[model samples]
Target: MLNIEKTFDQITAMGPVHLKIFTYIMQMLRDKYDVSMIDFDIEKSIFFYGIDSLKIIEIHSALEARLNCKIPTEAFFQANTFKGMIDDIVKSISNDGNLGIETSHYSLETEIQEALDYLLRDRPQRDEGYQTELTHTTLLTGASGFVGTFFLKELLENTDLKIFCLVRAADEAAGLERIRKTERKYNAHLPQGWEDRVQIVIGDMSKKRLGLTDEVYQEYAKTIDSVYHVAAVDNFYLPYNIIKKTNVVGTVEVADFALEGKIKPFYHVSSCAVSLLEQCSDPPTIIGLVNGYAQTKYVTEQIILRIAEKGLPWSSFRLGYLYTLGISDVDLDPNVSFKKLLQLVAKAYDKVEDDFFIEADAFENFLMAIPEIGCVPDLDANFDLMPVEYGAKAIIKTSLLPMSELKSCYTFYNPCPLDWSDIVNYFKQSNKRIEKVPLNTFVDKYAEYVRHTDDNSIKLLKSVVSSQLDQQLNTMFRQIDTDMVKEDIHWCPPCEKQFTHAYVDFVLND
Candidate 1:
C-alpha cells in the first residue's frame, strides 16, 4: 500500500519535498495528541475512526506555514488519504501552483449528510429469534448517571423484574459500587435483598455491542423484555465524531441488540434539542442542528422511526433539563442539569434583593454562574424545568404502556414555561443586589467575556449555555402540547419564583 504505518523518517523513498509535507502533517497531529498511541494508517483516512475538521484545519495551517504556500480549503476534504494529500500537494505546486476546488462545494450541510451516511450505514437485520414479550427482565444503560440512578430506584421499588444495568466500569463489582454511590448521592438507598435481582453488566456504550462479547451480548439480549437506552455522551460541545459514537452509533447498537433476541419496548431517553433542528430549520431539515449533541439525537431519532416501521416497538422521551431530589440536600455533583448549575451559581452570591432571604455569598455564586441571569435586563425567554423525581416516574409509567398507544415523539417540557420576566423579578425580589440584565445584551457581551474569563466554571457554564440556551432563546417556540406525552405537563411544576430563594438556600447549604 502507498499509505502504510511508518514514522516520518521511514518515508526516505519519497522525494525530499513529499517527505517535508508528510513530516509537517505528522508533527501537527502530534502537537495535540500522542501520535504514537494513535492508530495511524496512512491507507486509512486522516479522519476515519479518529480526527476531524478541526485537526485537519490545524494540519492545513501548519503545512501552509511550513511551506510558505497556500492550500485550497477543499483540498483538505478531497485529500482523504495520506498518499492523496501528498499527490494533491505535489500537483498543486506543479500545476501552476493552483488547485481546482471551491470552498462553496463544502458546507455544514455536506458534513451533516456525511454524518447521516455513517449513522445509517449497514442497518442491522431483525434476528429470527426476535419475539416481543411482556416485561420481566429489563436492560438499562446509563444506570449510574444522574437521572439513571433515580430510574434505578424507581424500578427497584415498583417492579419485580430483574434489572440488568449496563454501566462502564472495570468489573462487575466496581460497577455495583458505582451504582451504590450514585443511589446514595440522590439518597435513594438500594433496597434490601435487591442484590439478587440487580445484575451489573460492565460495559461502554462507546464500544460495539456495549463492549460485551457476542455470547454475553446475545445472552442478555434474549432475557431482556424492555430496554431503557438512557446512556449518551451529553457534552454540548464535544466534537461531532466523539459524541456521535455514543449517542448515534451506540444507540443503533443497543437498538440492534434489542432486535437480536427477546423483543420488547425500546425506551430511548433523548433530549429536547432534537426539536431544535426543526426550530432553526429554514426549510425544516435535521441538518439545521449545529451542535454534536443535538445532531446525534436528531439522527438517532430518525433511525428509531425507521426501526419502528419494521414493527420493533419503541418510544423516545425528549427530556428537558431535569432537576431531581427536590430541595432536600439537593444533588449537584453531576452539574449537568440546569438546576444543578443554578445551585453552583447560588454559592457565588451573598444576599437577596429583598436583602434578607438570601446570603450575599449565595447570591454572588448565582450571578457568577449566570452573571447575566442574576441581572437580566430583559424578560423575553422561557425556562423549562422538569423535576427528575417526577420525570423518572413519568418515564416508567409511559414506557410501560402498550406499544399501540405510544407516540413517536414524547417531549417532557413544562406545560407552563416560567417567563423570563417572572424569573428576573423572582431573583430581584430575593436580592436587591441583582440588576436587570437583558438576556440578549448579556449573551452578546458575555460571549466576549467568556473568551477572556480564566475561570473554568464560567467557561464550562458558557460552553453549555451558549450551545443549548443561546440557540433556544433566539428560536421562536411555544410550549408544545404534551397530549401525546402520556403525562400532563401540569403534572410537573414550573421553575417558579415562590421557591426561588429556598432552592438557592438548599443548594448552598448542601
Candidate 2:
C-alpha cells in the first residue's frame, strides 16, 4: 500500500512549486474521483488505474489555475509517474532553486521520433515475388469491432480466402462469442457455413508477437497472405502514454509480423483524424493533433510510410466516422458520437436524469447541457457520416487492387456531410425545439443552470464548465481529403435520408 503522508513528507523538502503542483493534483483527484490511494505506486502516474481521462483534464486545468502558468498538455500525457509530472510542472512554473527532477523532457515530437526508431530498429528486408492477388488466408485484427465486423462479413461473403481473426479472448470459443456479439449488435449476418471460412486466433496486439507463442507466431507469419489491422484504443481523450502500448506499439508488432516471413501486403485501418495534420511537412509533428488517438494514428502512419518506403507492399485506409453498420434500420452502437449527441437532446427535452454518461473532457457537459439550458452553441461544424458498410466495402475494394496500381493511402470520408444546422432541423421535425444561440450566451446559460443544480451528473458537468470555459467550444472537424479513395475506389456515401432519419429516430425513441 502506498502511504500518502510519507510521500508528501519526502516531497516537502522540494520547493513550494513542487508542493503546490502535488497538492493541487491530489485535491482534484480526491474531490472529483473520490479517490484515496490505498495500494498504488508512488512512482507510477497519478492516473494509475480507475482514473478516467476526463479526470486528467480536470487536474490539468486545476494545476494551470493554481500555478498561474501554462503547462503543456504533453507533459501530463507523456509523464511516467506522479512525481515526474510534479517535477515537470514545477520546472514549468519556476526557475530558481533546485526545481526538483526534470523528468519527461521530450516533447510529443521527440516521443514519436523515439518510438519510430525503436519500432523500426531491426527492420527485415522484404522478400521477392509478393502475391498481387488474394491467397489462401488473411489475418485480421479487430474483427469484433464496428467496422471490422462488416469487414469480416464482407470477406466471408465475397472471398474464397479463409479469414484468421486475431481476437483477444480466453480461448477460441470466447473469441467466437465476441464476434457473434458484434454481429448481433449490428444485425449483420455471416454467410451460411461461415465457421468453415473463419478461424479464431486468441491473441493480443499489446504483447510481443501478438501474444502468440514463438512457434505459432512464426507459423502465421509464413502462411498468412495479407494483414488487415483495425484494432486500436480508439479513445479521443486518453493521453498518448495511456494508449501507446496498444495503439502505437501494437501497430509496430503487426508491422513486424507482416515483414517476418514472405512479405504480406499490410492494409492498416487508420482514422480520418490523421488528416488533422495531413498538411504538415514530410514528417508531420504530433503537436498539431488535438488528442492522443490522433497522435498515435499519426505516428503509426509515419511508421507505415517508412515501412512502405522500405518496399513492403502496404495500403492504409483512413476511415471517417462509421455512423452505423446496417444503414437501413436502427443497427447502431449506443456510444457512437452522433447517437450520444442525440441522446443528450432526448435527455434534455424529456427532463430525464440518466446516471450514465460518457465521461470525457472533449464531450463533457455541452451535449447534455444543451437541452437543460434550452440553447445550442453555434458550433459551425459538420460530420463525415460514413456508413460502416461503405467503409468496409471501400477497404475491401481497394485492398484487392492490383499491387502495382494501389496507392499508398486511401482516405474514406463521406462526400455528403451532415451539418450541425441540419441535425438541429431534424430534431425540430421530431418536435424538439432548441434555440441556437451564440457561444457566449450558451456558456452563460450553462453557468446559470449549474448554479441551481446539485445532482451527481451536474457535479461532473460543472467540474468541466466551471474549470474551463474554452472546453465548451465545440470540437470542430476539418474536411478530409479523399482524392485517392475517390479516384481509385470510386465510392460515395449512400446519401439516402433513410440513413440519417433512422439514426435520429432510433436515438429519440431509445
Off by over 4 Å in 2: 11-41, 47-76, 86-127, 280-289, 325-369, 424-433, 439-509
Count the clashes in each prediction.
29, 0
Question: In model 1, what lDDT does residue 398 have?
Answer: 76
Model 2 TM-score (2 dp)? 0.73
Give lDDT tens digits, candidate 1, residues 1-510. 222345344555667777777777777667675564245666566776367654554565556556755554445555657667675676566655455432122233444455445543563544453435455789888888777877776688768888999888888899988887665555454567767888998887767777999899878876677888888876543434456677777887787677665555788887777777554443232121245566677777766665566666777787766665333223334325555556544543322233223222312343455544445546466655566766676777776666677766677766655555665665567678767754556665554554444443343333334323544643523556543333333335556664554554455454
Q: How accurate is candidate 1 locally (lDDT)?
A: 0.61
Best by TM-score: 2
Q: Which candidate's lDDT is highest?
A: 2
Worst 10 residues of 1 by lDDT: 355-364
Instruction: List residue ranges in candidate 1 displaced over 4 A.
Output: 1-132, 279-290, 326-367, 372-379, 430-440, 461-471, 474-477, 483-491, 504-510
